[model samples]
Target: MPRSIDSFNRQRLITSYFSVTLSITLVLFLLGFFCFLVLSTQKIANHFKEQVAVTILIKDNAKSADIAQLQKTLSVAAFVKSLQFISKEEAAEKFSKDIGEDFVTFIGTNPLQNAIDLSLKAEYAEPEKLGEIKRELEQNSFVSEVIYDQSLVALIHENVNRIGLITLVFSALFTFVSVLLINASIRLSIYSKRFIIKTMQLVGATRSFIRRPFIRLNVRLGILSAFIAMLLFSLSLWGIVKSYPEFSILVDAWILLWVFLGILVMGILISWGSTYFATQRFLNLKTNALYY
Candidate 1:
């Protein structure tokens, strides 16, 4: 009968340990996922910003040599991410294809102007920089006009700022919630052994001696939980990369490494701190208080 009771208690203890470890692992995974999103926000924004193209239309009488010189100059500019020259013939063909008719042939002339599609670097995508670039390009003798959607540029800027602010707010809120959750799990696990702690104290165990094992055990649990969380996060990231290969370019390996390390350190610190404080609380309680 005594052995049966011991077996049941041991089983319960193991169950409790597993429960606490699983809880911590889930919380850490969510926190780490949010951290990764926060870190990659800027990169994602830049990727989209660089896709907005500014078109420079060429004058009909522009010499080929002058147009080539202009292309060479713009290609090396600090603000330019990439540029593609579209000849008038290519523009006419594309328009004809889109309309399902050869408008150039019908009119007996190709009216489309030669143009250069310019994609600016992320930093120069702002309204002020774009305005300066447009003015600069329009000053060129061979350039007829510089054209881009001003409203679209403004909209992108507004949306990026809004998204960044919202992400930061959610990151902070989730971090607080994660801390609370981990702390609660640790306290509950310690509570289960409150009687053992008191018994040890009654037997003349020093406070540090009592805390050492609990703290060490919880720290190990914390590290294990962190590893589990990181594994789950890596699998999720892998799935994302598989679905959208381009997304992999936005996430830096060093940033991911740091996030993983942060999770490990956070797990260990929170577990040790929570366990120490929970055990300390029980240690300071009166023997009679144990019943309540």
Candidate 2:
């Protein structure tokens, strides 16, 4: 009968420890996932912004030498990501295909002007910045006009800001909740060892001496939980990359490393703090209170 009871208690203890580890893993995974989401959103926003281009129309009588100089100057500009020179004929061909009609043939002349289509870097893609750049470009003698889609720029800027704000607010709330959940889990796991703490105190062990082993154990558990969560996170990222190859651009190995380290730091801090506090309560409890 005694052997059976001891076996049952040991099995129960193992099960409890497994459950606590699993809980910590889930919370860490959630935190890592939200971090990835915030990062990916920023990448996607930059991708869209870089796709916007300004069309610079050249004057009818602009010299080829002047056009070449303008192209060289624009290529070296801080704001420009890239530029392509479209000759008047190329512009007419594109326009003809776009409208599904040979307007040049119908009129026996191409009214389209030679133009430079240039995309700005993400940082310079804002409306105010683009406005400043446009004014600067128009000051050139060979330039006739600089045009871009104001409505599209405004829409992208607004939507990106909105999404960033929303993610920040929700990430803060969820991170707080995650800390609380982790704290509760660590405390509960320590609660099972309260009697051992009390016994050590009665045997004349110093508080630090009593804490050392439990703290070490908590640290180990925290690291183990972090690695487990990271493993799951890596698998999820792999699946996403496989399903949508374009997302591969957003997957930065350095950022993923930071995410993994962040989770590990969080795990260690929360577990260590919770274990220290939980042990304190037991250390102060009177012998009779142990029954409760």
Candidate 3:
């Protein structure tokens, strides 16, 4: 080959490799960011679940001993995240303070009901589970009607699901676009070596043998691209931490590892897909097509 032709091919291959690497990086970065958002939302959901406080009310005539026993039972229940025993006097005082009004004028006697304010862990903090818990508590002889803000709980559940669906939709759209870009880059990368592919085919190279070098190159490209993508993701997270210092708590090393792994896997899959299609196209070309 002429020196100029060799130099041109060398530059083309280099450029093609870089293009594939950059495209894979872009795709993985998008995917990683999407994963991060999902994980962050899940963390927020956990915090929300932890804050869902459950209030259990007892009958006015219930014995103190029975209420204590109930509290103890709840404290050990599988669904109970935590339990706080609110005595009648304490509840009344809290209500009075919350309202910022004295009940002394309206009440001839203390009509305050005994109650136990329970706070569940994040895992058990769903509407259906909460309803079941409330039902169980109400079945107790010492317990009166269980009072909880049902509307608020329902609203929260509905919003959480709605937000989750929106996130999924956005992620899917982004993923579709990324797949096309990455595949196109990989295909173009392989296409640049089409003449060499034709030479190998004319020499009776099996499809697998012809694809071996590309696959090997692709594997390396996948790793390199994944690292690049991970670096970008880490930078994004660092930006986030800089903007909101509080986010550092959730941005731990394990989460970063998950992002790295996800990026690497995405890179490998996309590279493999691109190589497969490119090789198939080249192999199917007529002998005269090589001159083109």
Reference-based lDDT, each prediction: 0.93, 0.89, 0.81
- Residues 43-132 of candidate 3 have per-residue lDDT tens digits of 766766677777777887888789878878878988777788777788778888999976744685678777787877766778898888
Instruction: Count clashing residue pairs in model 3.
Output: 0
Please report the candidate that would top lDDT against the real structure: 1
**Per-residue lDDT of candidate 1, residues 130-249 (tens digit):** 999999999998899999999999999999999999999999999999989999999999888899999999999999999999999999999999999999999999999999998887
RMSD of each: 2.0, 1.8, 3.5
* Candidates in descending TM-score order: 2, 1, 3
> Candidate 3: lDDT of 193?
80
Residue pairs clashing in model 1 are none
The candidates, ranked best first by lDDT, are 1, 2, 3
- C-alpha lDDT of residue 39 in model 1: 85
* Candidate 3: C-alpha lDDT: 0.81
- Count of residue pairs whose backbone atoms collide, per candidate: 0, 0, 0
